[model samples]
Target: MNKPEAASIGLVKRARALAPLLAEEADEIERTRRLTPKVVSALIKNGLYKSLLPKNIGGFESPPMVFMEMLEEIAKADASTAWCVGQCSVVGMTAAYLDADVAHQVFGKPDDIAAWGAIAHAVQAVPGGYTITARWDFASGMRQANWLGAHVQVLEADGTTRMRPNGTPEIRTILFPASSATTHDMWNVIGLCGTGTDSYSVENLFIPDSHAALRDDFSALREKGPLYGITTYSMFGLGFGAVSLGVARATLDAAIDLARKKHSVGIAAMKDNSAVQGLIGRTEAKLRAARAYHFSTAANAWQEILNTGKLSEQGRAAIRLSATYTIHQSAEVVETAYHMAGATAVFKSNPFERRFRDMHTIAQQIQARDNHFEDVGKMILTNSVIPRGPTM
Candidate 1:
């Protein structure tokens, strides 16, 4: 196998090796509403956070399939950890688009971590760079990051919004030291709380031009690797969909275990019941189907990039379809497993409750939204999606 292939296998092994520790720390993570320092340190030590970073930056830069598999393995132990890893790893992909000096400054160290949130505010243009007083929310894994990024619309010095050549508002992701911002405790949620997906704000912080990049723009690409050809957005979808599958697999397995050991007073043993058997069979089938489709889509997309050095519009649509469909299907499998566990599923001591909540939470994220189906369907129907060069 090639060096990349070998590196991919090694990373997945590392992730699997860390699973038991994640499972052990799961409760503490939930209680603290963030990953325990032990878990964070372990992940850092393993270099799992740099899974999607460019190889030139001392990262593994593993294939999309390997990325998904590693996240899935971690998710089987702790979905929040998987979510945080998935988010931060994809954020690292931005390094490929940035200037080499700036990229190294931001993500150079072994333990360096960077986190960012959705686009919300605009940064004011200046001669050297941009100045921004803005707050960004939903920054997952922010607690441990030493660097932070903000995706913002560009406001020109003359009080006009900068526009891309395509006529859309110009957006740039500005990277700054995490110490420059005020971190907030805003990640209170029903599930995936261990991610520490908090909010933060910076007041008139000046970011040099070198510290920013037009994310996912073809023209802005600085690192020309086949892995960089895939869009960050699609990588997020693929990774999170894998997380859902892991959660579903674990939940279903727990349900199966409960069925084997628990028996009601009146009804027959759950494992012996024909109905329970059928449900287990069907749920397993569905979970496997979803996983298969998810991996196949990712593999096909990666293969396309390798063959043609670009991802086609059809490939992008296929990715969206597979990710959304797998997320929804995994949720169904989790629901079925939770229901099968009966009273046991409701108890916090059992695995079902948390996994159930986590599964639903994954289902509700932007990656799993039902509208993705409509979007991809529209694209497929039109056949007018101009095949762009490798771009988001």
Candidate 2:
């Protein structure tokens, strides 16, 4: 895919400038067990929070690559901010797959701020629409969000759950009023503490016929634009993968600083060890590879959209795999940096430890690097199709 013109060099400068502020708020966010309103407001005002928002709605509507670059910077400063914003941006992209009317209602509001979660455990059926009931876990960004998309399995009119072509129950993702759901203050986790990825329960919440959109049938969407191209879904992998990469980058940088000054009992300085130097070189190489792969894949699919106005299924899968590869490897790179940081990484207050914790959480993400590998394998080896479910 052809690469779009590079983002203005000025964005890199701006992202660098915001790093200190993000770092300063790390402690406060941890103390509250959620990102404070102050941090959210600051990020939004700085344009960092909506990096992936559509251009029509006063956003940069940046390419997936640009957003990925920014995420690395944000994670270097604070993994929580990267995590929160990445989650929000992807929800905005999902808006493209919905009916045009639904998309309009979602982004239609001047103050619309969206978040998404999947209630895979909750399933119920109604006449025209469906009833969703369950506690969505790890619904990041819900604290500051105005709306959320919850994934559900559809139940048919005959009281039987709808089934996919594979005969597994077919599922749908429904957009729900964020306020209609009640949040439970149950987000007590060691990593990603500030994400407020709490348990939120919606009891018998009835969604109208319009708000439900089946991801598997994105073509049925009435909203047709360059954004509808499969590359848009690449943002899911692009944005979050960058977050992990950023955390890993920060961990390495911090470790290098610590290594330069410390003198072990037997060694004159940690940096003097050839092994440590080799690890640093390895970390740099992995980071560069992640950046290249991410941009190349986003460029591939987006270039097709700009030229032909559409991307085929094969192209979409490649971008998805690219995202997964970049993010998953990024975790390994960061863990390498952590190992070089020595035993000090075990302390909770240490930035190295926090980054390690945050990077490890990437494995738990719904679109995890491991799952992406599995999906790609399925696509290649058999007549098997991409698993269509509430969650992509």
- Which of the numbered candidates is closest to the native, going by highest lDDT? 1
TM-score result, candidate 1: 0.96
Which regions of candidate 1 fall more than 4 Å away from where they truly are? 384-392
Model 2 per-residue lDDT tens digits across residues 213-270 = 7764555545455665554356677678778777877787888888888888877688
Q: TM-score of each candidate?
A: 0.96, 0.83
How far does residue 124 in candidate 1 sit from its true spot (Å)? Answer: 0.9
Candidate 1 local lDDT, 276-371, one digit each (tens): 999999889899888988898888899899998778778887888889999999999999998888887899998999998988888888998889
Residue 339, model 1: lDDT of 89
Model 2, global lDDT: 0.71
In terms of TM-score, which candidate is strongest? 1
RMSD of 1: 3.0
